[model samples]
Target: MMTLSNLTSPFPIFHFIGIPGLEAVHVWISIPFCCLYAIALSGNSMILFVIITEQSLHEPMYYFLSMLSATDLGLIISTMSTTLVVLWFNLREISLDGCIVQMFFLHGFTVIETGILVAMAFDRYVAICDPLRYNTILTNARILQIIFVILLRMIVLLVPTLLLLKRLSFCKTNILSHSYCYHPDVLKLACSDTKPNSFWGLTGLILTSGIDIPCIIISYIMIIRSVLSIASRTEQHKAFSTCVSHIAAVAIFYIPLVSLSLVHRFGQSSPKLVQTMMANIYLILPPVLNPVIYSLKTKQLRGALLKLLLSKNLPMSS
Candidate 1:
């Protein structure tokens, strides 16, 4: 069994994700990722703007939508800043401290993003399942409190794992197999035994991404049940259409997540570019598609977007 450490001097490692002979692909993907980042930032910014400006959107669903947009923007920034740096330099080596900070923010927003998604799903459930009580149940004060607590908990939960990772000895290998300082990727390169690292990291992942997924499922389950119970066909259609974007967003985000996990567990050392591509997709695609998904599927959001754009054009037209 040839170990990763046994590889030849200089490691012959490609700069992109670990895929050999696929550096060009990484560059190509980076171009689109930049585009995706722009879209995530701009689109989410627009959503935030519309939500804040429009008095009518002060309800629970829009409130959660705003929060979701904010978190998605954070998620994109956290994941892609380090990613773009790696691509620009084409450098595979990250210092231990740099790696730890990257890992910390990367997963910090990841947990909070998952929590935000779960919150949005619950908001939708309340709106659809208990419409009569939606106003009282998801008031501004309550929503703000929930968001604050979730954000605080996510940051606190992620910090200790990051600190634990920082305490490990690197044993001279500074080359990270992935583009960013992923916990598992960094742990793999550690000179010391990694069982503890792997165990805790997996535990963290399960708590954040893993646990949040099931909760999303349950929320949607209730949402679906409630939608079906509506007596009017028009109401049922409206409710289902409202959920289309959320379902699409969930699928877009999680599919890449599953793919990335599988690649990490199975494709370690295969090629750097492949690893890079997976990571890039994991970080970039969801944010890019999120606004697009919601704008196209959600009538209120689409109207708000169009009105905002038209308003900007009015001065030029005059």
Candidate 2:
């Protein structure tokens, strides 16, 4: 008697062909992605460390930035570490359990990242729109509790989703096209019926991304409205300037993700390289640009960075 579990025991394998034209293009493409990944990791790590050690940055805005930086760092690591291993060593075989674990972390971190972004948006909204209440609204104790609740909810929701995905009998072909075991890619390989998976997966994606994006949009909308109401031109400019970094960061994050989704659903025939590039952009670009955007746009952060740099160069100057 053949059992369903045993039938799916032959874990799937994946491979990338080094086609001549594509290979040449990939070499050039991979360099920048590698650089971006390094920068993202290093920059986010620096932000996290600075925020933790610097008492001056203990305020609500920098506290949220620290949390966001940590999440961004985790996001890049969750995606790129496996990708790097596969790309460099050409290791393609993934056990069923290994694949499931990867999917869980990938999905989990993505959800957490969105939650952190939402938190940051709310922080900004409180800061600019309700300055009098900012202290009460975003106190340390309250912010910590909110982050804890958000993380708890994200984990509790995502674990069941991944477990449900794991329960599906993967009797179909096991060759995953993408570098990671993304939910959509994994669902495509399930031998059992996937209507439930498809429905739930899409629903979850829609609900999560939908909720976070709208919250961000609404925050910025209110911020803009508040900016307009300010009578002083200089104050209005200062208020708007504070949000420029966040806007740049959000656009870089969402645009690539949305584009990748569109290409996946609509342009199935798009070249594999193109798909890979877009996927890498989502994974790499946001983190790479996030710290840069925030640091460069905020005079305080830029001053801090410059001071740190000057301190480092003081011995040489002497």
Candidate 3:
């Protein structure tokens, strides 16, 4: 028995559509979504565990990998409860404050991950371009400094976004088109002018992922040039082999992200289901596949995971 006054009150609550136009099958769709969440959670947790516990992995490269896993975990957990509850139980009501908080963490973690990937590219560049100076270049203190800089950048960029959203008035419909809150999604629902919010959101994106991708490309070009200068083909192969894991990780992360951005920008005419599905893939695929890609591509990580499993199993079996 809700009144129009309550619905349109200054403290209005927002509702999510949870895959608009597909309500009848939401329960069925939750199965695969749940499985993806399970895999992302366990895989990232395993990566963090192996990297932290194995003293052999206490290097700059693995430190970056561990940070990547942690960011992925944050991204996944940020949307987990809201998304699953909407799809599984039709619970779509969320407070305006709650929506803003979710949007903050989701985009914040994404920005941090992009920064980490860029740092990893720098790691690969140093490891290959100047192997002799790699240790001096990426000391433990330097690694910690890079991590602090990433977090600080995200905070400074996102605080304005939150403030802009806070000043907006939401007199129009409070229904969001997706299962979780995103800056763009939430901004579009505001009855007032959202130019400031939109501008900050785009600014944040360009500064983070937009800048990161080009830098990563430049780093790779340098790495390839360095690899080619090696006197022996065996040395060249060894150098390129070290990069395969990082390259795979970059591909899996950026491809879906770029695709989703394109779809959002140009696919307004496309089916709602198509946009929704692409968004889901963009959010879920990276965390689920990153660990698998590393485990398959990096021999040392695979060996460490094997040893960890064996040690645990031996105790239980005994």
Candidate 4:
């Protein structure tokens, strides 16, 4: 018989509970979760495929959309396997290194997505606010440079958090609250002091998501001012219309994120099911909704998608 000590030895394996206090209904719950995952995967994949294949989409804005799709794909991949395993097979055991890897990718992809949103905001800002200089400012080389900088920033900031986590000794229950391994959720399982881990984690959050949100807001503020300054109601409508898809994407991504944070901080007495649901929404909604929003709102993407699909269905000439 395996002893309790053997199960939770220093840096021992960790298990994830799909949703605390809701194991009895995990199968039923997984039905929706699996559907959402499929949607996220298919939608983001279609966006990437269309953007890459359509030469007409070789613009800075579309490039940013590609990056957004890539980031969402990464985010979904980071958690999908582990989450599905837990839900489908109840295989919750995760080694320490595996957990760390999951935490890194999950948080890193999230930060990258946030950075991409900020970049997209800047793309919109330039397109709307400084249309004359848009092409000159967002040259292909410059966009590539911006993506490199965003990725480097995320990696540098996340390393410290991972290092701190690795240093902490886990001697407690070794069970994670959610299906996925998050830095904070993992940190809570450590028996040793996690102040450094917590401090660095919070700092990382501030540096990435925190900074990105304000910069995005500032970009939109400038965009709104520029749009309003246009004398024609028609031009103003056009400008605002261009921003609608981005605004919707931002809202879906941030609202659940903020709600999850609030629930974690203030809803301690709230049911675990509520907290888990919010977290799932935060993880799943944006990836599933963003491409749909873009496809519906952006005429260029819709037209390209229709053309692509129609071409595939048409008979090939010999």
* Quality of model 1 by C-alpha lDDT: 0.75
Candidate 3 accuracy as TM-score:
0.94
The candidate, 1 or 2, that scores higher on lDDT is 2
What is the C-alpha lDDT profile of model 3 across 167-204, one tens digit per residue? 87786468776788877767767777888878888898
Candidate 4 residue spans exceeding 4 A from truth:
1-8
For candidate 3, which ten residues in a row score worst on lDDT?
Answer: 3-12
Evaluate model 3: give its lDDT. 0.88
Per-residue C-alpha lDDT of model 2 across residues 1-318, encoded as one tens digit per residue? 877766664454433232224543544555766888889988998788777777777888888888878878888877675666565665667777777788777777778778877888898899999999999888889988978977896777777677776666776347665677776767777777878777777777776788889999999999999999999999999998888887787788789888987877788898876877777777778788889988888777777777776887887644
Per-residue CA lDDT of candidate 1, range 30-96, in tens? 6866877888999989999999998877777888788778878877777676677656656665556
Q: Which candidate leads in lDDT?
A: 3
Q: Which regions of candidate 1 deviate over 4 angstroms?
A: 1-20, 24-29, 269-272, 316-318
Query: What is the C-alpha local distance difference test score of candidate 4?
Result: 0.87
lDDT winner between 3 and 4, please give it: 3
Model 4, 113-145: lDDT tens digits are: 888899999999999988999999999899989
Where does model 3 exceed 4 Å of error? 1-8, 315-318
Q: Which rank order by lDDT, best down to worst?
A: 3, 4, 2, 1
Question: What overall lDDT goes with each candidate model?
Answer: 0.75, 0.77, 0.88, 0.87
